[model samples]
Target: MRKLIPLLLLVVHHFASAQTKDERVKIDSILSVYTGRSVDGKGLLQEAITLSQQSDDYLLGQLYFKLAEEHLATGAYDSAGKYYPLSLTPLEIAGDSTLLGEAYIGMGYVLYLKGDYTQSLNYNLKAEKIFRAAKANKLLGRALKRMAGVFIAMKDYGTSEKYLSEALTIAEEEFDTINIVRTLNTLSVIYDETGDFKKVDPILKRAIALAEAIHCIRCMAISYSQWGISLHFRGQYKEAIGKYRKEYELNKLEGLTFDQYFVYQNIAEAYFELQNLTLALAYSDSAMFLAKTENAPQFIHDSYKIQYKIYKAQNNLGKALAALEMKSQYVDTLFSQEKARMQEDMKVAYETEKKEQLITLLEKENTIKVLEAEQSKQLRLYLIVVVVLLVLAAGVLFSRYRLKQRTAKLLDAKNIDLQNLNQVKDRLFAIISHDLKSPLSSFHTVTSTLNQYYGQISQADIKKYLEKLEVASKSLEDQMKNLLEWSLHQISERKLSPEVFDLKEMAETLKSFFQLSLEVKRQNMYLEIEGSIPLETDREYVQTILRNLISNAIKFTPPEGTIWLRAKTAGAEIVIEIEDTGIGIASEDFSKLFTLEADKKSIGNSPEKGTGLGLVLVKEMIEKMGGTISLASELNKGTTFTLKMTGKQQKQAA
Candidate 1:
């Protein structure tokens, strides 16, 4: 009977173990379906949690960890923080170091978000140690990156860079392109903050390229934004606008609404620098709308600041003041939020200390009670009282220190903002005063000469003066048109009105339009089109683009120079080229050709009056018409501007 009882117990144990294994598999299947999904998986996860409670500790811990991640994704940080810790004990019991490390990382992130940098670093370090021991290079790299982020938030850039460098090396070794790109971006940010801009550009370029290679849209967008910021800081507003537009397009494609808000704000600031008040106002408004929709006070504050600048530039004092007032309100709201976060961090720290004290006291009491009863009771009471008093004092001191630190940080940030705002204002004012005043001064000079010397001037001199006036008027009209068209292109109100147009006929029309300029410049223009090439695109946009390109060709070409306009069907596309046999652009100046900074530099040998706005407008129009433009130029040879657009047959086939 004794032998039979032992055998029956063994059989029952085997049966129970098998049942637990089956239940674990079921729980894992549930997690596989629901984890990381946006849909509410809480109810299903809860059911899994129930099933897991009686199963192996590893499965239970994994279920809890997944639940925490879901909560974290939905911004329910409190619930996430609560559940992450719930996973630790079960995972430790199961001796699953990998999941345990992941749980620690999750807790670290929660603490980091709560502004508990010290505790966050501790948790991340613990995870890093576990991942290192397990030879989990990917997780280890992630842990190191998290540690770096904590240090970055604490303004310890050197230490942050150290961790990031290590993580970057690990990612490179593992061929983890995503992590490599991410680490490079973080490193670039450090360089940017330290004002080592030369290092920033290469790192960001490499990161952007890697992101593109991996088809990581989000990573590419982030890299572009950081690059744009670097360019913006250097006062390259046109180049910065180009980068920001790339970011905006990617974010729009991915339906990332929140990211688009920041992109719009960035583009607005760039336009503001270029003194394009219309675009600045439009983009600022778009950012403001998104900020309001997202209920983001910091973004709202930033948007208002840009709007204030735009309104002030437009001489709308009332609107500027209103924007200023709104900005102040958001600033106050942000300050309040910061204070609240600090208080919450302090509260968390105090509660944590109290709990630790309680556990220590309980342990000490148990030890003392084993040796002496009365002494243990007195010692426990005394220890509790002393611990509480010390904790309270430390909490008070820490709160005061943190408050002072927060105030100083806020003051520093405000000072930087003020300085940047002042710089932007000065630049905008300088550009506007210089560009606008030049044309007006020319007009005043020509008109004054004609009015003052009407009787004294000969017929030939009067004709010359009248011609000068006409030239001034034409220059001002061109400038105004470029500004208006560029602004319309940015705000996206200029919709594409595509129609079938014969390329040769359009070339003839542009030739006729530029006949007078051609005659004055003593330049010959040639048109070549292959067998009635038909392009289906916005005619006005195409015309504007060609007009700008041709005008630029004429301006740069010396007397007796030749310009060629050619169009042909290439596969499903129509290719057009505007080639000028004049002093060509330097190879180094190619980047500056379609940018606002190009206005500051003379491209070719000829001394031409240009604002560089024409090329910028041409670029915008070509893009709007779903076409591309490229240029090939040599210093002393010549320059050719190429355009490729979809053919009418291709459009109709699609």
Candidate 2:
């Protein structure tokens, strides 16, 4: 039994080692799934981190390294920063210099995302030394490329180009298609920024071809994004939008959230440049939505800025102000983030300095004083930033106040114009009423006198009364002509001139004449002239019909309702329709409408009394003009009057 015990221990120890190896394999499998872009790296890494913490394994460093990279790829800089150092701890403990160097590269990327170019450069330099020590040429090239990106972001074009040129050489020698294409895209961007557009397209083209040849979606997305940027810089906004759309579609299909966010941001800018405010705002919202999820403060800031611009372009000042406020919030957040990062770095420096000074008793006393000075400096800087943001916010609010004041003044001017129009309408109506009443009253008196004295008088007296009636009738006719001329300028003094006229123009004229009436009722009028309308009847008759139809529409229509004057050409006939969203005629009133019966009277919505003779007159006139008129109405709904007239109708009558 004692001899078998050693065998059992040996077996158990072997199984434990095998189990650890299997766990490591599982971790690598999970990482492979994430790196292959099959699933979200951040989620899978979180699970891996949990499992790694539960077990002591040699793969822990690699897991932490991959987790940090996932965070970096998602633009979670702070999280990446934390994870990168954690990764370095396990790698250093395991004596894996290769992974430790990779962790440094990840940290460099985090710092780059945080906008600390100098610190990122320092980290990249350290990574380069580690890679060179391990004789990893490809990795060394990667570090160089990263340094170039930092320089590009810093606007040090010469230094960026120098680094990129070296990286490209290494990438070509190593047959690294990804890095080769990426470096080309980056160089294109630098050239584009330098306004060397002529040099930009060729470089981008090469990158695109290589990326396509390699079937690398990420490379293609990067090249397409840079191409879009170059086109955008050249003022080809629509073309840029097309390129950006390709990038967006590719990134979406690949589930690359960061790439999609960048594409959306670029698309927003392109649309904004094209003066397409709606599309710009839509893309900006998408960018903001993605940026929020990724914790990408810079992209979030950019999204708000684009939204603000779009709102301003649309003349939506209130919304623009709101967007501006949001932009300011993000700006403040980014500033705080940068400030906090700087403070963290300084604290690290202070701690390192304190440790070094403690080794030398002479420098230890001054270390506390130095820390106090740094802390005081940071406090003053925070106060200054707060005050500056407050002042900026005050400026934005004051601009909003000024905009409101201008809007109020503009509204006041519009009101004055409306009041003047109303006054003109009143005066015109007064003149029309007086002219009509005088002629009407004279005709009535003459007829009444003749009727009463006919039996008592002789034939000569009757003839004299008849002559007086004739003069009164002529006078009434002249006054009616004047009124018609004043109301309808289309009416000629000699005779009714019927000719083909633009139906839209006639409708427009009618709309203008009834503009005041429409305004008074708070109603809207629309003209829907489908095509050319050539009427065969007299223009005066058409005008009179329309005037009566429009006046009745206004009187019957309630406040905030609509009236439509529509005309369309139907083969040999021109069909005109006047529709009103108003209180409609009753079923019984339909029969009485065209008849001169005692019941043919209606009080409109405004209590406007009418003899209902308009429709009767219209029907008679339509028949005389060789045309037809029809009416459709519903109770409390609306009314539609349609007229079918043709040039052939007049020819047939002739």
Candidate 3:
């Protein structure tokens, strides 16, 4: 026994030495061919693929997949997509589960970027099923995260949330910080949609913290963009604008036109709302330039809206209407673009499904051959062979089954995410067709009517009609704000410029504007300020935030419902609470409050149908002002919103 052990040890050593030499030779060969200033990744990948085929022959499959993946990273989507599947043929034959699944996922992601969302998802599912069968949880989580984004595009919020949550659990269990942050950003949008600001805000804060900790600029940009949008919806215009600006600054690199276009669009809206028309116009021009350059219909839609507002503000009614007409045209164009994406997505999904079924058929044939050989050999040999075959079959089938399950899970997630986007698309159309269209079309008609009646109608009648026209114009302006708010939230971040002001007076002014509204509802309204509520604040911002909240409460509450808006000193904090007896929110919705994700549904109440963004915007703005807002609500039992601003907030913290 001792002599045999020595012989085994010598053999193991020799094998290890030989393997080490082989590894060294392969590495040296790759380096020798690729090294030097003139090295080309394409050349290296091509050579590697060729050499892999000639060398060990076993590594060729993996090398092919690697070469394709490297190409994908360099934006050579066609090259990567082609080679990745070619590598898959060898991996399938070799039963190389690891490389096969990875290669499929790589192909899927590239296809998705190429606007082939269906193919991307199909491949992702194939990879997912394989990983699940292998119990490869780490890879499964990655596939789920990617699928979550695809689902978001499909307007399937529920499934997207499910996959994102599953991915988050896996990340936490594995201590994978990167996946955690990515999942959180995706999840936050859903929360924002359903008016779950509490959940949305904290998730964003955590995502930002994680991104900053790791110095991941891209993730930071995503977090900041989400954070800004949430803030914008909450009426935290200043902070939201700041976030958008940071995103713009960071993304001002080569191959970042898409990111910059959105940022510019947001900045224009933010500046417009802040009443800085010049800045708004500048950003609008910037957005338009990018839109034209990139052929992004969405950005073009936003640009025309901004230009319209700019012209209207300048009292250039002719230019304003022309811009509005242009905006309407682009809105129509963008709708078609989204439609095309949806159609392509469905087509690709169908085709990929067919291909996967074929792949499965081939795999099954292989399994059947092995089963037949084992079964024919049984008896005493038969019993032993049968058990082994059965076990192996069970293992493979179970792995395949689990992989399919996980792929289904990922697809479901992508569907839910797409549903959210679908809502945005639908809602955008709603705004254009129902909301803005009605008013702008009316604006044009009314102007024409007034002109037609000019000679026949009395000056007194004209004056009265002009007054009515003024009121109509006010409504138009208000409608335009909704679009502006949408644009600002989408594109910019916190841009607060704080100044010293009296909170009490601002509250009183808010109360004054709602006087008629209060009377109409027969609601009792109270403003409580024990002393001078002076703080460093932006007057217009304070007014807008207060107006939206107070008006919201008044609009929602039934007749005679009391609204208590109290501002007082609690240490160095000036807390403002707008409490009202209105229709309360459901508990199921608490988790999605601030998620502006494409998957979330925006809900509002009564005569004051809201942007579903007012609360989110308020939350964001208050936070930027070194303040905080909280919601205390009960369904049909009134809701209370509190905004607490810091007394000595700094100037440049954001």
lDDT of each: 0.77, 0.70, 0.69
Worst 10 residues of 1 by lDDT: 3-12
lDDT per residue (tens digit) for residues 1-654 in model 2? 234333433332332445556766776677667762235766687666554442442465677678777766755566567667656644764567777877888899888976878889998999899888998989989999999999999989999999999999999999999989988988998898787889888888898899889888888888888899889878899999999988888787788877788888888888888888888888888889989998988888778877866876786755765776576567557656765664553454345335423332322233334445567775454344334434533543454345346434644664565466445345435545554465567668867877887678898877776766665565454444333333222111123446566667778888998887688679999898876555555776778778778877887889999999988877888788999989887766677777544454353244544445466567766766678998899889999999987754432211
Model 1 steric clash pairs: none
Q: Where is model 3 poorest over a 10-residue stretch in terms of lDDT?
A: 6-15
Candidate 2's displacement at residue 237, Å, is 3.1
Better of 1 and 3 by TM-score: 1
Error of 1 at 130 (Å): 0.7
Clashing pairs in 2: none
Q: What is the C-alpha lDDT profile of model 1 across 339-363, one tens digit per residue? A: 6754564464455446545644654
| Residues 468-555, model 3: lDDT tens digits | 5765665566555545445343333235666788888888887887787688669999988887878776665677678778867876
Which candidate gets the maximum TM-score versus the true structure?
1
What shift in Å separates residue 392 of candidate 1 from its native position after superposition? Answer: 26
